[model samples]
Target chain A: MISGPIPPHPRALLQDLWLEPEATGLAEARPSLKVSSSAKKKDADPTTRGPKAKASQGDLREDDPRERPPYQGNLDSEVFHLESGWKLLASDLCFGKGLDVDFLGMDANRTPIAVLALGEEDQDLCPLKLLDLKAWFQRNKELIRQTWMRICPELISLDLCRDLRFFLIAHEFSPSLIERLSCLSSFDLLLFRLRSLGVRGQQYWYAEGVAPWAHHSQEVSPFEAPSGVEAELLRERINTFLSRVQVVGEGLVGRSLDFEGDRFDRRALIENELVLELGVDQGQVWIRIPGIPDEFLLGTDEEQSRVLDCFLRSLMARNHPTWGSVPLGNSPRKPEQTQNEGKALGGRPEPQPREDRLSSSEPEKDSPWGRGNPCRSSKHAERSEGTRLSDEEMAAFFGS
Target chain B: MAKFFDRIFKPFQRHVALPSSLVPPVVGIASGKGGTGKSMVTVNLGVLLGSPRARVRILDADLGLGNAHLPLGLKPDRNLQYFFEEKGSLADLLQHSRYGVDVLPGGSGLSRLAHLNPSDFRRFALGLDSVLEGAAAVLVDSAAGISPQTLSFLLASDLVLIVTTPEITSLTDAYALIKCLALRRPGRGVSLLVNQCDDSQQGWRAFEKIRDISGRFLGIHVSFLGAVPGDPAVRSALAARTPIVIRTPSAPAARGLRACARRLEDILEEIPQWRKVPSYGRRLLEAQR
Candidate 1:
């Protein structure tokens, strides 16, 4: 079995290894191999649609916001399993080092099912990931059995599993990928087009059995990436999201605004008591909590997200007097006050209370921004003249 | 299984996929030697490029040994390890810094990603494109040096901004990296950034030195993309985990970073529509091969 590398011919680099005139001609010589009998049948059935036909639709783009499926959930819940006839043992099962499956459970036949879901962005690599996962599962059958038993401890003495089924869900499976699936005869491969249907303006994701005729598809709702425009969406989404989010806090350090940069630390009177400094410059929105010293950007991702939590609470409390009427701690809104229509946030809608609309907007006679703050100097009074925050914005700020 | 891995790990097609107009320009920040302030410059540029019209992302490509997250005062939950190990996706790992720019924090001090093979590059790069789903621009803060891994990244990008300090070794190494890229990809756009300069003249002189040599010997014109002067304010800002440009806009280095960012933006705009190109991962695999 001794072997050595062989030298290439001198003109190898100049040769076009990919394309050949002879190969193109050979296809014509063997027409049957190039064009299947199904192709000729297509002439008889003009209504038969292929991937190209489905893809040509103007609004069918995978990335188009209009084309997004209704439901945006993991589809591993009891509601989905009852609807789809599958049992989910776990979501996001991890291997010791590298490999992890998106889902693992059992089909109706008690046959173990492993699912790998990908989105339109990862459509190209869907087949490859499937192959990798299949290979891993085949090699580590005992590992799977061990984990399966661990999950279902009661199913101990009996033979835990026999046939393993792999399910792949994506927005759309390319024709080539389905064609490749034909060769993978040994594995019980189930391909589905991830789908969603709106139920009263709400999106609930489900799996649709993919057939040649079922060309339409979508991935399990991929969280849309946040862009500059999405930042505005975040503001709108946060308004509904933060309506109920509040903090039980006390003192806010009153600091003078540095009148240098493009943004000014303008005082916002939410009601008449609590004052919030908002950062809004040329349409960019951010919130600043002066009481919490977040001078440098020294904050973790968790702490920053807390800013979104305190957004409505801090913004709404801007005008409420801190000494008397201020809602500090859990004293502001009782759980009973929020018995109204749900306010939508991040797709999941929370009912908003009509009686308790976050806060009462009654104007105070001694409003700081509306009337002259007799307590402050004239310079401080003039600083609050212009309110830049159209609505309001904040960072992972208003740090608690 | 072998057949499947082969297809997955296969190199690029003989001809590139046609370059499309929608392709966002990915810029790589590289320095041949350490202590060239590449990460600092990358973070600042990311901050400067943040605007209403465009979204910017800084990819700390330093792998296991990265500190790009430190400057922004971010503690990311997941790093490159999480992505490579399939524990998390790129979006799950993104740390939205308080500065408005998103930071794709790199793995810190883990040898797992230090020796990535071609297949890994392919997987990582393909995933990198999804980050562009929201962002208009991505700045790859390449680790200091011309390692095969680093070079693969430099070649995958549309533009390479080589950051160098006034130190002789830094300049020499920067030239070395540029030369390597020039050889691998002839006439590849290489921009020069002279960091830690005493003044604009010193920065310009440093740029001139590298640009002249590369032009004379390599016969390639290297762009001098302005310079950031040495300032004590940079140190103060670093301590605060805030970029100097945001902290002290009047500082010399802040002004320089702003100018460089604007110049880079112009260069990005001037880029002629390329024929459709492969995804970043596919390009990475091609470069690795």
Candidate 2:
């Protein structure tokens, strides 16, 4: 089988039905559609009486025979090269085996293309005919190459026929024909409506549809490096930040700091348990503690104050003795005094009474920070105190 | 009486369980995203698994854009499309490559084969049964992502080998594929092979992260097959149109692949006899429904 839907014409349907069975047997028995090389001279002559008789016997009969267009005989092949960029290599390039392409030409990309022109008078032109052309091309690419080489040896140096494209130039394409052509994506087939315009007795042929070979180049250009003073400043800032951060995991690169880069969210192991993910969005630095739902923004004063105080308090409470050796550029104070004073200086809401704080902690049974009445323990109270520190104290603690 | 009944009815069963030797385990290699080296792993593993005493066949199931034969340095004249169209048998399409592997090439740009009807699926399954006869193992290189066709292949196989790189995107996609597979075939186990790793440690770390997340969220166990290190020789071999295992057998990636192949062989050997039926095509057809 034929894989796609058939056109509505009964004759075309019948031909399509018989195409598969006859594809091999008919290869030898079918008559050649190509104009014979011996008949080239006669076909080329505009003054010859043969095409006039043939045109009259078919559809091109005018009211008077003398009113026939001047460029009537053998003009189908020449019309492609008149104004179109296509340069014809051979006309009626015969395979000599009942198969021939109308015009063999090279596109701008130096890719070989087979052009088949369907005349209005040709009764045999159908979807099955196009299929036949494609099948013949597939089977005899080397033969077509040899014939082209025999005709013009120098043009063979351009490129071999790795992907030969087919073009059907017709007066009008039926909807069914377009549908049939759409199914043959592998062939890279193109259909063009051949528009014949007579301007001041000059016949001009325009191939109107987009050529398959004329697609834009799909090559991707390398990304250009960022330049200018702002870019340099941003790069320097990001580099400085990354150089200061400690990256401690296997195969873990330094936390990427550049906001504009694709890997802006940098993850680094903190305290050997928590993952510190730092990212920048809209010129504001944001930090997220992975496995925790809370996000800390470091761009604004209030958020910076809250996050820094919380971090320092958590560290100090968790490792109180090691807190003295942190080199935070400040003297270590008692955990109780640091918690009380940090909250007082930070302009945060006043802490509830010790009993109320203890009561609130009861409902936080599953909190990662701790379970049940954190204020009941002096260590938990100190850590909670660290979460409410002043902006100035945090700035001073970091020596920024 | 039991022997007489067995003799009378065994030949008439629709689901005939062939001998384990005749019904080689089908391993489907897949990825969540494209360019994760699924085909590369499948081809190299086929070569590693093949020996004088055993035979391995690779079926290129990436219908539209298959390049599995590229590494083998064989350009097949016919492919699965010919077999699908009845122009040739599955045996006719099997091309022997340089490294003692049989490849059933998936012809490029044949989109029709990506989706098969019921009859076509039966024909394809029967064709595979004939092609895979007497093989020790059959590796199916599936197209990346969770397309219906890829899912069908994964569902049909006895095992799925998910290939991924250390990149976050690759890991995320691999997880997505595991999630999809878990939702569809919850009982099936998938093996993870991290490709292009900086080291075995890095590969293990990536695998652990994916495994932990999958276990916690999807409640599925992902087996760690192993990792193939990123080696320059692999790229050079690819450019030269050869498998790195054959071009530079001692290279880090090749050695890693050999170790992975051994692990896979051990796993295949442990499979029970009842699961060794060559019914991947039938399973795939049922999955498609």
Candidate 3:
């Protein structure tokens, strides 16, 4: 349906609609109007250009930062380089902080041919179509396939993914496209944060129906199969993810599922390089990786065990610090064993008066942490130095 | 003709077309920890205190790893790196932000600064002073830890704001930092700002240990400036790359930062009155001689 004359000065109209102070929602919705006229056409002409043509038209005044004057003040010399590129892109870099995905269309030589700036949350408020790619390449699939093959040297071949090349679905994704791109792996299609995915979110796998070889086209192969370096990186990432999950679990009491167990399963997937499992229970999500044998850790290295031991210890400290430290490998705590195991420990304490601790002497030295005392020399240097405020400071600090 | 001539030379009479005497004292936010809320506080406080005429310049001194642009949601047409590389004056590197505040991004490829002779450091300092000549206040967010960059910038600034969280480790490190600065510049103008406080009381209590220890040992009183409460809104705003002062000014954390800004004002007013204690660096050199 026509929204009437479509407001000639669309950005101006958006500004008028958004400056209300209360118009934040509409303000955030402004970037959508920048999409090309082609996006507005029904599968109709299949021949209209988008961001490129519009970009040339200079309709995206917001994107052209030059309109803003350069800062003219005492500036640090080195930060100038990053300031230009560190902009809030019209789109989210990753959708909902889920996956990190890169779509690089390359040439026959596998050189960088084209980089796709995928739809970000703010940019594509409305649903988007993968078919947009056809427009992106001007319906030149063969070239795209060749470029894909060249870029994805590890993938089997582009021809195999012809059927699953690209498709579109009417769906809405939350978080942002950038975040979604961060969590994706060809072998693993798990959603890290299901809560942020708005309704109608679904995966459209272009390589779904293709043969393993076809799906693993040289262009898409690297994404399909893990490389030696990638495998190692994934292992480290999985360990980090497991640690973060354990941290998250500390706050979850009687959660929907065993987050820590699921983390182990994901680690297993990375270890075995076979079978990916993604599931959700209540609010907790799980990705039960398969194929790793139970004997993988028959005699784990001291370093690996130490890391695990430290991780488990931190989790216990966070969840049940007073219950007493549990030794690793005694079998996970059962529900009965988990209850009322110990007193509350490791919890942060309340703020108290501290300035009085100082002697009102000649030096005016008031470091409660003993900034200069020779008597406490050995004990002084070991403490972390991050600032924490006193009670009166906090009160008067925020009260103003 | 006489009046016109007088007006023409009026601006040059002062030798510097500096900002009004009412200009607020520039306070820098620094930390020994990486993940502390230095940038967050600096950006928010700038917005709170910023005005068209009395503008606040947030100089991101984190250099190579600066993230002030991320929290403020601003993208510059040119960054400070270009200025440093091209021998551009600090004034050349200043970039206007979407928010009303002005910005002077730190250089990223400052490995050169690492090897810079004293001449280069002097030129850098002069460029910065020129660039900041007319600002109402300059809020510097320094790189984490005691790198040369952080120390150089910290020493150059009029006031230093040390940010830390409530963890014991963080507090301990904060005290060590105070001790370092005190030992280096015994009476350096420094203040403490606590972030991610469980409560107002907790924030103050967290600084209490450091305040007392520093007072008793170092013979220095690092002012307990203020604290920002642990607010999820701050994180969400950061995730979205928006400043919370604009997104949710009424939030506890925002309010806290504003209060700190005010406290900073009061502290700044008292600076000239406080005796300048020789930085320990100077004292140590003298002692060695």
Best by DockQ: 3
Model 3, A1-400: lDDT tens digits are 1122321122222212222212223334223222222222222111332322333344333343344212111111111111111111111111112211122222221222112222222235221332243234445556545653353343322233222222111112344542442232231111111011111232111000111111112122110123222333544555655554444333332222222112212321111111222222222223322222122231235534544444334334322222213343243354434443432444443222222223233343322222223222222222223234344323432343
What CAPRI grade goes to candidate 3?
A: incorrect
Structural similarity to truth (TM-score) of each candidate: 0.40, 0.40, 0.39
Query: Relative to the unseen true structure, what is the C-alpha lDDT of residue A340 in candidate 1, on a scale of 0 to 100?
Result: 34
Q: Compute the DockQ of candidate 2.
A: 0.01
Candidate 2 global lDDT: 0.55
User: Ten residues in a row with the worst lDDT in model 2 chain A?
Assistant: A216-225
lDDT digits (tens) for residues B1-289 of candidate 1: 0011011111111012222224556789999999888888998887766532244678888886888888888987677887888887777888787554688887888877877766776778788777765455678898888888898888988888999998777877787787677667653447789999987778878877786555433434466677788999999999988777666654678767756764565456444334378766677778888
Scanning candidate 3 chain A in windows of ten residues, the lowest lDDT window is: A204-213
> Evaluated with lDDT, which candidate comes out highest?
2
Residue B154's C-alpha lDDT in candidate 2?
Answer: 86
| Model 1 ranges off by over 4 Å | A1-400, B1-21, B272-275
Which stretches in model 3 have alpha-carbon errors above 4 Å? A1-400, B1-24, B108-117, B271-289
lDDT tens string, model 2, B20-76?
344567889999989988888888888766632245788888877788998888988
Each prediction's total of clashing residue pairs, residues at least 3 apart in sequence or on different chains, is 39, 1, 107
lDDT of 1 by residue, A34-112 (tens): 1111222222211322222222222121344344322212111111221112344443344532344545665434555
What's the fnat for candidate 1, on a 0 to 1 scale? 0.00
- The chain A TM-scores for the candidates, taken one by one, are 0.30, 0.34, 0.21
Local error of candidate 2 at residue A74 (angstroms): 76
lDDT of 3 by residue, B15-77 (tens): 234333323345767887778888899887776555433457787777666667778777665
